[model samples]
Structure formats: structure tokens, C-alpha cells
Target: ADHRVSLPLAALLGAAFLPLADVAARVIDRPAETPVGILVAAAGSPFFILLARRIGRR
Candidate 1:
């Protein structure tokens, strides 16, 4: 019934999975495309920052 509790848990899960996913992708090393680690993070930084600021404002 508590949205706040679930939100934090989901965020924590996402934070944990992001790094793990990147690490696994790099290790896999596909022949077609080199595994890219942290590409999502790199691309998402700006959007994440903007989101954080907006959330902080509220």
C-alpha cells in the first residue's frame, strides 16, 4: 500500500542491475558489435540529471 517504499526498492533494483548488465555485456563480446559497457549510463546521464532536478523541485 506504500508507494514510497516500492519506488525506492525499484530504483535500487535498477541501480544494481545497470552495472551488472553492462559488465555482462562487455564480457560476452559479440563478434558483430563490440559489447558496450556503460553506454546506457553515458547516454542517460543528461536525462537522469534533468529528471532528478525536476523531482527535487517538487
Candidate 2:
């Protein structure tokens, strides 16, 4: 197991899932609103960084 490749790949997979979980929460017709943690994690994850960095992060 190569930490160099695997760790980043794991981080990326976790971060990618963060946003889907958020959307699922909001779309599931739950009584309560989505949790703050989910929203924060979705926005703050490296998935967002990966997206923005591709757009130059301006």
C-alpha cells in the first residue's frame, strides 16, 4: 500500500461522497433540515478544491 497515492485517493473519495450525501439529505423529504456538518463538509472538502483549482481558484 503506497501512502503517497492511496491517502490522497482516499481523501478524494471521502470528499466526493460528502456532496452527494448533502444533496441526498436535502432531497429525501426529511422533516428536519440537513445538518450543519454535512453542509460544511460538502463545501469545505477537497472535492471543492479540486473543482475550483481547475477553474483557477480566482
Candidate 3:
């Protein structure tokens, strides 16, 4: 889509998400903060690494 069409929709959706992201950021803001998404991503990384190692062993 053209920028004219997309920009308006993006602004509408972004406004809805902005408040939620702000709330999440506030919740996640801690001294030793580990974001939920990041922790999940890190947990996934080990699985991928193990898969790669198993493939290499073949």
C-alpha cells in the first residue's frame, strides 16, 4: 500500500498499542529486569543451538 493509506492505518493501530507498550514497559522496568519476550527468546535459542549441534553431528 502507498504511504498515504498505510500511514493513517499505522497511526490508528499504533495509538492503540502505544498505551499497552507503555504499560508493559512500566511493568518490566526493574533493576535487574528480564523482559518476558527476551527470556522466552533466550529459552528458544538453546533449542535452536542444540538442533544445530545435532545436525552437525550427522
Candidate 4:
């Protein structure tokens, strides 16, 4: 397995998620901010599971 593949994937996921977190923090709260890790995990877990399942199938 190319373990190095995960590094770029992780970076890309963070890059994609920060803006979403920032937007949610700005629009969904007036004086508070949501943690980006929560948003990332909420979205990433399902995706990671699906990807793992597909890879396992192969």
C-alpha cells in the first residue's frame, strides 16, 4: 500500500473543511464558533467508511 497517499488526502480534506467551518462559524453563530474537527469528522467518517468498504471489496 502506498501509505503516502493519505498525506495528500488529509491535507485536501482539511483545506476543503476549513472554509466550511469558517462559514458555519460566521453564519450559524453570532458570538461563538464551531470546531472544525467536528465538522470534518461528521463528514469525513462516512466518506472514509465508504472508501474503506470499496477498497476492501477490491
Top TM-score model: 4
TM-score per model over all chains:
0.49, 0.50, 0.41, 0.58
Clashes of 1: 0
> Residue by residue across 1-58, what tens digits does model 4's lDDT show?
6769988897898788789777876666668877766776877799999999999999
Give per-residue CA lDDT, model 1, range 11-56, as digits (tens). Answer: 9987987877777666666654344545666657898999899999
Q: Let me know the TM-score candidate 2 reaches against the reference structure.
A: 0.50
lDDT agreement with native, every candidate: 0.74, 0.76, 0.69, 0.80
Stretches of model 1 off by over 4 angstroms after superposition: 30-58
Candidate 3 stretches greater than 4 Å from native: 30-58
Model 4: how far is 52 from its true place, Å? 0.4
Clashing pairs in 4: none
What's the CA RMSD for each of the models?
5.3, 7.6, 9.5, 3.1
- In candidate 3, how many Å is residue 27 off? 1.1
Give the C-alpha lDDT of model 4: 0.80
Model 1 residue 17 CA deviation in Å: 0.4
- Cα error, residue 47 of model 3, in Å, equals 23
TM-score of model number 4 = 0.58
Q: Distance from true position, residue 53, model 4, in Å? A: 0.3
Best by lDDT: 4
